[model samples]
Target: MLTRAEDGLENLWDSRRAAGMSEPEKLLCRSNLLGSDKRITNYGGGNTSAKVMETDPLTGAQVEVLWVKGSGGDVGSIRMDGFATLYMDKLRALKGVYRGPEHEDEMVGYLPHCTFNLNPRAASIDTPLHAYVPHRHVDHMHPDAIIAIAASRDSRALTAEIFGDEIGWLPWKRPGYELGLWLEQFCRDNPEAKGVVLESHGLFTWADDAGDCYALTLDVINRAMAWFGQKTHGTEAFGGPVRTSLEPRARAAVAARLMPAIRGFVSGGQHMVGHFTDAPEVLEFVNARDMARLAALGTSCPDHFLRTKIRPLVVDFDPAAPDVDAVLGGLKASVEAYRDDYAAYYGRCRRAVSPPMRDPNAVVYLVPGVGMITFARDKATARISGEFYVNAINVMRGADAVSEYRGLPEQEAFDIEYWLLEEAKLQRMPKPKSLAGRVALVTGGAGGIGAATAERLLREGACVVLADIDGDAVAEVGKGLAAGHSADVVRTVTMDVTDEDAVAAAFDRAAVAFGGIDILVSNAGIASSAPVEETTLAMWNRNMDILSTGYFIASREAFRLLQRQGMGGAVVFVGSKNALAASPNAAAYCTAKASELHLARCLALEGAEKGIRVNVVNPDAVLRGSRIWSGEWLDQRASTYGTDKEGLEEMYRNRSMLKRSVFPEDIAEAIYFLASDLSAKSTGNIINVDAGNKDAFTR
Candidate 1:
C-alpha cells in the first residue's frame, strides 16, 4: 500500500551497523527515527544529513561541511559513521542551475566532493534541497502509502478534511535546486511546521537532532498515509503505459493530438502541451512503450515544462492515413492552438504575469492503439504529472474501454492548478487511529509484560491470542478475558519460543483459533545478570534458549504464516534499555537482549517485502515482579536503593527526564502503538520506552 523510492536508499537510518558514519553521536541521533508510522518513509525510501564543523580536506582549515547519509545506506540504520562529507557552500550554490536532465552535467560538475570516491556512491538528487535546510540534520523520503494517496485527483480536498493546518503541498518539481529554494522559503515562513508534503512527490522533515528529524518525519507520514488509505480505491490494476519514448519523429506525431486535449483540459476548453523527462524510471518506462499512449500521461508533474513542453504535437497515425507530412502539419497546428489557449488562461487566472505564456508546460504525443504521450523538463516532474492525469483518466474510463477521459471538470482543475488552498487545509495533528478489523499475537502473552500489552490491544478491539511458555498462566488469563465485546475474540495458546516445533504449533493454533494472527509481541524473555568471568554456560544457554532463540522462533513462524496469506502483520520485541546502554556484571543478559534488538531490526527489512512490521520495545529498569525479581532479588534491589518496598518501587519513578522508570504498562502501550492499525507503516525501529533513561551521553 505504500510506495517507496526504489530500495536504493534502504538502510539509510538505523541504530545498528551505522558502520560508515564519521562520528558516534549521529549514530545515536539517527536511531530515534523508527516508529509505527509510514509518513517519513516505508522501509527505506529517504535520506538525511548533518552539518558539522570539519576541516576542509583541500583547504586544511576548520570549515563547515555536511555529513549526509551515503546514497545507499538505510536512514533507519544510518549512523553518524555512515555520513559522507561534502562542502556546504558548493551545495547551496546549486540554485538557479540548469543542465541536461540525464547527466545533469552542469550541476554534477559544480560539486565534485559529493562523490565519495569509494563504494560508488552518488549524492541523492535532493542534495541541493538538503543543503537548503537550516537545521543540523535534514531528512527526505517518499512515504509510499502517503504520497501515493496525496498524488491522486482529490488529494487536496481529502488531505484538507483530514489535516486542516499541518501540511504544505507544493506542486511537483524535479528534485534539485528549484525545489530546494522553494522549500527553504517555505520552512522559513512556517518555522514551526513539522514538514512539507510535496504533491506527487514525497515528504521532507528536519531538526537539529537526528532523532527528532527521524521521529517527526516518520510520525507525519504515518498519519497522512493512514488517512489516505481509508479513502483510496486500491484497485488491483490501474493501467498506464508501462513505457514511452521520444523518438524525434514519434515525439512530433504525439504532440499533434495531445495538444488539443490538454488545452481544452487546462483552459475553459483551453490548452495542450508537449513533454520530456530524464529520470531513470521514467526513461525506462518511456523507452519501453508505444510513443502515443506514453505521451498522454506526459511526465512526472504537470509543471515540468523543461523536459515535457506544455502540450505536444498529436498526430493519429494509422496505415489507413498514409500522408505523414500532412500529419506533421496537423500536429504543429494543434500545438499552436493549444499554446494560444494556455496564454489566455494564464492571463485570466494566474496571479502573476510572465512572458511566454504561450510556452506549454507539458507535451503529449498520441498514436492510435498505442495511447498518448506527454513530456516535461525532467523525468521526475513528468512522472508525477503523468500519474495524476492517468488516475483521472482511469476514473473516467468507465465500462466503455474507450475512456472519454477528461480532467475533473475544467473549472475545478483550473482552480486547483494554481490553488493556494494547500495551506488552508494543512494542519499538524497528534496521531490518530482508525483500525477495526486488524488482529495481533503477543508473545509472553500470559505474563506481566505481555498481559499489559494484550490488555491495551484488547481495548483497541483487536482479536488477539495470549501466547506464553506457561500454559496454565496463559489459560488462566485467556479465560478471564471478556470475549463478548470483541470480534472473533481471544484465543489462549502455550508457546515455547525456544522450541521450533512448539512455536510452529502455536502459530497454527492461533490461526485456527482466531482466524489469523495480525500482530506479534515477542515479549517472552528471561533476564539474569552475571559477570562474564563468573557466568556459567548453563546460564548463557538459558538466556539464549528463551530470549534470542525463542524470539527467532516466534518471528520466523509469524513471517511464514503471514506471508502465506499475502496480507501483513506487526511484531514487537520487548527489548531492554540495557541492550543499547552499558551495565556492569550483565554480559550474558545484555548479549541475549542485544541480539533480540538486532533480530527485529534485520527482520524489519526482511518482513517489509511481505508487509509484516517488525520493531523493538526497549524499556528501562522496569521493577515489575517477575521470576528474575524474586523475593531475594527484590530485597537486594531494594537494599541498593536504600529504601523499603514502596521506596524501592518509587526510585525508577523519578529516574529520567520524565521522572519515571518504564512500567510494564508503559512499554505495553508503546508496543500496542507499533502493532495496531495506527502503525501500519512502521517497522524496524527500536522504540525507547525508557522515559529518556539511556540518553547516550551525560547531556
Candidate 2:
C-alpha cells in the first residue's frame, strides 16, 4: 500500500512553526514528501496547497489565505516562499463572476491582483481549482498508477465500483474556471467524497489537515491499484518487445545517418542535437504488437503535452541501406511530411484568436527496428521530454493491462497545448542564453580547463561533447553535468587524439548524439618539464603526439563534419605561454605548442572559405585545479624551482604584470569568446590568458 511518511511529520511542523513558520512550511513538506516519490510525480510535475490564517496588511485583521504552489518551483524541492499567498475572500469572489469561454485566462490574470502582497510571484493556473475546493489541504498529482485507472476507457464505471461513491468523478474539462466551478459544486453535493478523479488529467484528494490530505491521496491510488491488479492478472499483457538485436556498430551507423537529418528538418535548418535512445523499455514500447495505435494516443497527462507533445511521430527505417546519404535524404523527407501533418492537425483545431502556433516539429520520433529519437532546442529539454515519454509508455502498458488505454480527446489535447494560461508561463520564462542552439566539443574535457570550458558552453545553452583519454573520468564528469543540464547535452568519448581512427569515430558519436558539431575546443595536453639534455626521444614524441598531432586530428575531423554540414563553424586550440616565450627545460613542450599555433593559423586559412574561424588561447602557470599540478608533479616542479609548491606558485603569480595567477576559467572565457559569434570578424589570432604575462603577449 502507498503509505505516508509520518514518523517525524508533526515534530517537523511543531519545531519549525515555533520559529514563526507559517502553514506554507507544512504544505511544502507534504509537497516534497509526495514529490519525492516518482510514482506520485517527477521533476516539476505536481502542485499542492494549504489554507491558513494571516494578518491582512490593509485591514490589520486576521483573514483566510490560500497558499498554493507557484511557478518555477518544483514540488520536490519547494521552499516555504515557493507558495504564493492569495486572499481567500477575493479568490472565492472570482467564482461568482467567472463566466463561460476561456475564463481561465482572466482567472490567471486576476490571480496576481488578489495576492496578499502587491508584487507576488505568479500563482499556478490551478489556483482557482484549489480555491473552490473547500478543504484545508489539497493534493493534486498525475500518478502513473492512478492515471492507468483514470485514463482507461472504462474509468468512470471502474472508479464507481472501486471507490463505492467515496470519490467524485469529473469528465475531462480542459482545466479552467469552468472546471473549477463545476468541481467545487460537485464536491459540495458529494460531502462524503474524499477525492475526485478528473477523467484523464489527474487525481485531487483533500482533507482538513495536510497529513490527512496526503494520506488520502495515497490510499485512493492504492485502492485503485489493488482493483486494477486483480482485474489484470498480474500485468502480463505489456511484455518486452520481440527479441531482435542489432550489432552495436551497425546500430550506431543508422543513428548517425538519421539524427542529423531529423535535426535539420525539425529546426528548419537551424543547428540542434538529436538525442537517440534504444533502451529496453523504449524498444518494448516501439516494437509492441499495436505500436502504431499505442504511440498515437496523447501524453500521459496534460502537463506532459508541453514537453512530450500530443503524440510521437512513428516512421519507417532501413538499417541496411547501402547509401547512407540516400537514407538521410529519405528521413529528411519523412520529417517534412510529419511537420506538414502537424500543421494540418493544428489547422483543424485552432481558434481564430489562438496565440501564434508552436513549431510543428515532432518532440518524440519512433523508428521501427532502429529506436526512439526525441528532438528539442537543447539537450536538457530533449532528455526531460524523452523521460516523460518513457514514463508514458510504461503507463500505457499498465493501463492496457487493466483495460483499453484512453487519453484525452484530440481537441482537448489541442486546447491544453495552446491554453493561454500555460502560454503565460512560457512567456514569463527567461530569454535563451547565447549559444543556445550551438553544439561544442572539448578535447581533454575531464581535465580542469577543458571541464570548465564544457560547463561554460552548457550554461550558455550549447550541447557539449567532453572527449578525454580517461573514459571513466570523462563519463563521470558528463553525468554530473547532465544531472544539472540535460542528459544529452554532455556526451563523453574516450579518445587518444593521436589516433586518426578514434578521432573519426568520436566525431561519428557526436553526430549520432547531437546531430553535428559546430565548435571544437582542442585543449587536451600534458605537462613535461625536463632539461634538454635529459629529455628522451620517447618523452619528446609523447608530448608532440598528443599536443600537435591531437590538435591536427580533432581539427581535421571538425572541419570535415562542418564542411559536410555546410554551416560556418569554429576550431579553438589551447596553446601555452611556452609557444610565445621559451621556458627552461621545456624544449618538447615549446616546440609542440609553436607547431600547434601555426597549425591553427593554417586551418584558419583553409576554413575561412567555409565560414569556419580558427584561433588559439595561450595560458601560462594555471596551477589551480589543474591535474598537471597535483602531488608528485607539483613537488617535482617546486624542487626544480628550488622552493616549496606554494612558494613556486607565488613566484609564478608575481612574475606576471598583473601580479596574479591565471586560472582555467580565464582560458575558458577567452576560448568561448573566440568560438562564439562575438569574435566573428577575428580569426587566426592568438588570445593570451596569462594574467598579463609580458613575454606571452601576442606580438
Measured against the true structure, the TM-scores of the candidates, in listed sequence, are 0.38, 0.86
Where does candidate 2 stray beyond 4 Å? 1-22, 57-60, 102-104, 117-119, 234-257, 268-276, 318-327, 401-403, 470-494, 500-516, 529-534, 560-567, 580-585, 609-611, 629-661, 691-699
| Candidate that scores best on lDDT | 2
Q: Residue 307 in model 2: shift from native, Å?
A: 1.3
Give the distance in Å from residue 516's predicted Cα in candidate 1 to where it truly belongs: 1.5
- Give the whole-model CA lDDT for all candidates, comma-separated: 0.57, 0.79
lDDT by residue for model 2 (424-462), tens: 778977887788878898999888899889988888889
lDDT of 1: 0.57
Q: List clash counts for every candidate, in order.
A: 116, 1
Instruction: State, as a TM-score between 0 and 1, how close model 2 is to the true structure.
Output: 0.86
Error of 2 at 267 (Å): 3.5
lDDT, candidate 1, 1-699, per-residue tens: 222433222224554534455442663356434412333343334667777776666667876777666544556666555556676765755554554343352464455555432323445545667778788877676554445444556555545565565766666555655676788898888887666767655667778765556556656655654553444445222243443445534543334333323333332211112232233333333333333443343322222222234334444454234454565456546656766766676666555422223334334443442344554322223343454433332222221122122222223334334433221222222222233334567788777777777778777656577888889988877776644433235678888888888787776555433334567788887766556787899988988888888888888888876664456678888888777876666677788888888898899889988788898888876778354565554665566566776776567677676786566788878888888656777788777887777553222
Provide the global lDDT of candidate 2 against the true structure.
0.79
